[model samples]
Target: MKLSLGEIADRFDLSLKGDPAIEISNLASIDQAVHGDLVFLFNSSHRKHLTDTKASAVVMREIDCTDCQIPYLISERPRLTWANVAKLFDPLPMQAATRHPSAIVSDQAIIGAGVSMGPHSVISAGAVIGDGSTIGAGSFVGEGSKIGEHCRVFPNVTLYHMVCLGDRVTIHSGAVIGADGFGFEPNKGAFVKIPQIRGVVIGDDVEIGAGTTIDRGALCDTVVEDGVKIDNQVQIGHATRIGGDTIISGCTAIAGSTRIGRNCWIGGAVGIIDNIEITDQVEVTAMSLVTQSITVRGRYSSGTGLMRGRDWKRNIAAFKRLSNLFKRVRKLESERGD
Candidate 1:
């Protein structure tokens, strides 16, 4: 879909700074953009490339418009504006209402109007799929599960029994919802299996990335609130509650019964311990290990950046000696008359 600079600015409520007639067909980075393509500049460090870029139109902040050679759209947040405009060119695929011949849909399942069942998909008994939802090829909607309106269960995704998903939820390929949590009891020198009786509850507009696993609760529901974005390979443990608008990056492990507050940003590879409460608006840096509850809203980090093995060993030795060194200093101070 091609649009002139004027049309784009009008649609996105941005201000046009250059020739409004210039047309743009696609979006690209500043370094890779060419004529007829649109590009965006967000960081001030990349401003030097603006003079040499050949993009027909650029989306940027009003302050960065100076000396720019191309027709541009000025916005307060250029990156977000670029995302909104890019959607105009790349729309989501429309699924047809018909079910494929190879799809196996149980007669006991309650499927709503306009639902699409792709080839080899399975809809089990007592399942309820809401209006306009799409079950992609090879996907499985387990028995008694309830999926809400306009949801997309991508190819090879699995929704286990009793799982509930709200409207517009998207589960990407290879995601497994309602999987059993890791639970066990010691019995006579051996580990005994503990029953996992609860399910998963996902709210509206949540997107679970590929290969992510959301475990079923041991006794109560594991909940993911509205607008939560969970990246690939994330593990959400049983009975955990993640608040609205929280963004958790890839490879993060959230242990059981944890309560994460609203609008929190959890970076990649973070490990959050069980039963901890993280306050609202907290930011957990990448690779940090959270061992206790955080009551304050602030940036919390606990991990060492890259360092040489020899230097790291020396730093650890120094850290171990600090307690004795402090004791010696205190003793000397106490003995001094002044």
Candidate 2:
């Protein structure tokens, strides 16, 4: 995985500030880097450590190079350059294009060229796996499911019947796609379960994190558009359509029938209620509860900031008297009127 500084600079369109022949064998943090390693300084506050770093080379902005003693590559966006560099050092092995002996593939299933099936994986009847895809151990691809080219379905992932995934999608371990949505009708002191008959359709380049679950729609397909990144343990409810390029952080819960717009950022642990429409480019901060539709695009937050217990108690008391205080102020203004 070694790369010369000149090669990295040319590939990433970065400016070379030092000897181009210097070879980088690995990547490490600025603090932990040894010789033959490349480090990056993305944060300005970390510039203080540049003078003392032990790395052979560094990736940084031109302004930060003044304090760097080692060979460095200049980039307008150092963090993004570092990300591209990290891909060169990715440790995951390439797919071998062979199925394990223990794998159970249905006779009616269509497996494409260069596909790899790991141990005990199942491909049900009428399923179609695209070229160069990898199905990891213990995964289950249900009947009529279609996985697109170069997708990776990690171990223990479940794609329920009729689910469709687009090209280059990555489903992490323990992810369950197209499970039944929660729908129950109240009847005479009892609850009757409603049938969830729809499937899920995921677009290209989407990465669903570990343990995340996307439920099938009750009447329509649950859709996730291209380039959406969903973090670990997130729950996307039935018939919800997440627009392209939305980023949903870990533990966020989006209720059924919600329409989230493009380029939106949903922070960690945010709760979005059912049937709400969130406009494009909206940003919902961490732990905020969204109960209504957002008509305008902007950053929205609804939660108290962290504070000491005693200060919180005082604020709660003041909040409880707000209505009465408003009434008293109105009366005082009425008496003073000329």
Cα TM-score per model: 0.94, 0.96
Tell me the lDDT of candidate 2.
0.95
Look at candidate 2 and tell me the lDDT of residue 241: 100
Best by TM-score: 2
Give lDDT tens digits, candidate 1, residues 1-338: 88988898889898888888888888888888888999988998899987788788888887888887777788999878877887798867879998999999999999999999999999999999999999999999999999999999999999999899999999999999999998999999999988899999999999999999999998999999999999999999999999999999999999999999999999999999999999999999999999999999999999789899999999999999999999999999889943
Candidate 2 lDDT tens digits, 100-207: 999999999999999999999999999999999999999999999999999999999999998999999999999999999999999999999989999999999999
C-alpha lDDT of residue 192 in model 1: 91
Q: Give all candidates' CA lDDT scores.
A: 0.93, 0.95
Residue 293's lDDT in candidate 2: 100
- Model 2, position 290, has a per-residue lDDT of 100
**Deviation from native of the Cα of residue 154 in model 1, angstroms:** 1.2
Evaluate residue 176 in candidate 1 and report its C-alpha lDDT on the 0 to 100 scale.
Answer: 97
